[model samples]
Target: MTQQTLQRPSGWIERSRPAVQWTALIGLSLGFGAVLFWLGVPAAMLIGPLLAGIVISGNGGKLRLSRHAFVPVQGIIGCMIARMLPSSTGGELGIHWPVFAAGVLSVIVASGILGWVLVRMRVLPGTTALWGVSPGAATVMTLMAEAFGADAQLVAVMQYLRVLMVAAIASVLAKVVGANPHHAVAAVTWFPAIAWLPFAKTLALAVLGPLLGQRLRIPMGPMLVTLVAGVVLVHHGWLSIELPRWLPAIAYAFVGWRIGLRFTRPLLAHAARALPRIIACSLALIVVCGAIGAVLVAVAGVDPLTAYLATSPGGADSVAIIAASSNVDVRFVMAMQMARFLAVLAIGPATARFLARRATANANAAAAAAASSTDS
Candidate 1:
């Protein structure tokens, strides 16, 4: 191949197409973030980009992101999780362990049963329902749902919808009671550092994690492997890594873009029909969790805010982000949220299997009934 043939000339408009799309994506994300922040919705970094991507997708623009594209993002999240711990379990949690543990378990069981019901009713596919209504563990659940024959785009929409709702509810409740609620996306305002060291470490880990996990046939391979490595390394003092503040937004933007790209008219219509019911059910779950929080407040002598944060159906990252600036007890909130996240992680596969079986049974029974009617 000659040099000229190999390096063909590019037109200005053609070259600008890629740049224009990316610029639009970035602009939309920032606008969404700013608006969500102004409106006091928590976790704007993730939610904003997600909604932006949906808008772009709805408008017929093509912006696709894959889980593999988000490997670095997941790695950053994993590292953040492992590194943000207070270096101790904190003795205060011991006082309310039983109550908090019960609260966490309640979220899992309640959401899982809801997932089961949704699946049996054919509201969502079995695997989609399993992870879509899950209370926490966003990265793991999304990956697992995709692995189990679910629609990743739908899972992202449903999952992030719930996350945003939970954040919205929390923000509303915070304002109702005269509390100064924290802005979870405030981390975005931090200046980006010369983060090459952390970036280098994260790059190596991100590259290695999926490869190893896939080799071992582990589920949600990249997230699980990277997260586990981060936890182990952080706890053992082998690696000290801190991601740049802006990186998380990029990660979320990519996932959102990819998800939005999948939104054709049919999917949007389905989502429009389904989202109200899903949002209503999610609010109900939050209410149930609030009752548990009330019980914790009464019995454990913790404040209502602390109890609420502990029992909130939101994921660890958002909860942690909000907890950072709130008057609530961070230790207790994290302890409870982490407990539920881990519990869901452990029990999710089993629940998914059960849902799949139930779905199969329902289909078989329906088919048999149809055959009998046909004979009649």
Candidate 2:
């Protein structure tokens, strides 16, 4: 009998140590922290990096301008809207079913239109474009789109880019309107060091949730899991973690930086050919959705502007932040936005794929007919 000996190769373990993984993590954390510090002194609400990293690496890019640019703008908008809402829930126009319905309808229409535009312009595959334009949870939309055969990477890029854009734009608008916004509530400073016990639990859930989601083949993976886990923890009172005051702003800045980096010459050249149609469709979608939202607001007897912002196909977090800052019924707007997002996350990709397939079939049929006629 002969015995065989197997020798391990050198540096095999080192080589397998997760390529370029730390780059995004370290960069996101440091960048977010720096932004937070610049916004204020020693604000511990620095979890922006965790969220931003999810957005950056999720798209296989370190950063992109489109995604990074929108976050702060959206945050400012969210803050302004939040201010508009009644400090106490016992106001004349309470959060009701009508408000919810209007918000949901607005998001659905806006997101659908945006998706269609992207598909027609070929900036992204139809399915991916649909999910990318959705104003709901980006991670959730990404996962669902993947299940429906959408391009996950493209969806991640689009969703994050929208967030960055919305955030940036909203912030500017808020500033213009003379709205004073609160920094993101720092997680560390809000309750004390021991407050993290609940956050740790929520984080554990976030980690486990993503793993489970991935095993289930969820699209946006960890990001969606973390969002859902955070919401649930908050709702359940098991975790009372507050975001740092500058967290949203800093997070958004990181998102903007990432998105801005995507503007390379080649990408821009491709966009140039397609940008007109894409912009047209996107604008059309926004108008239609905005109209719908305005009508709903009127019917619900709520402030039209808040409804408009909530229903806008921008981004949930951005809208949430706007609603928060502007006193615009943050819960209602955020809830509706989340709902619409869920709908898009669930159905947008399937709808886009269906449309794409139909277009392809029609083109093929037309080509076949032309050939037959020539032969005849």
TM-score, model 2 to reference: 0.55
Task: List residue ranges in candidate 2 displaced over 4 A.
Answer: 1-95, 98-102, 109-165, 176-178, 181-249, 261-266, 373-376
**Poorest stretch of ten by lDDT in candidate 1:** 178-187
User: Which residue runs of candidate 1 sit more than 4 Å off their true CA positions?
Assistant: 1-19, 38-42, 90-100, 112-132, 136-160, 171-189, 192-244, 252-264, 301-310, 314-335, 349-376
lDDT of 2: 0.52
Whole-model lDDT values for every prediction: 0.66, 0.52
Worst 10 residues of 2 by lDDT: 41-50
How far is 80's C-alpha from truth in model 1 (Å)? 2.7
- The number of residue pairs in model 1 that clash at the backbone is 1
Q: Write candidate 2's Cα lDDT for 126-220 as tens digits.
A: 45566666655666667877776766665565555455445444444444442434543343243334556654553355346555545666543
Return the clash pairs for model 1, or none: 65-258
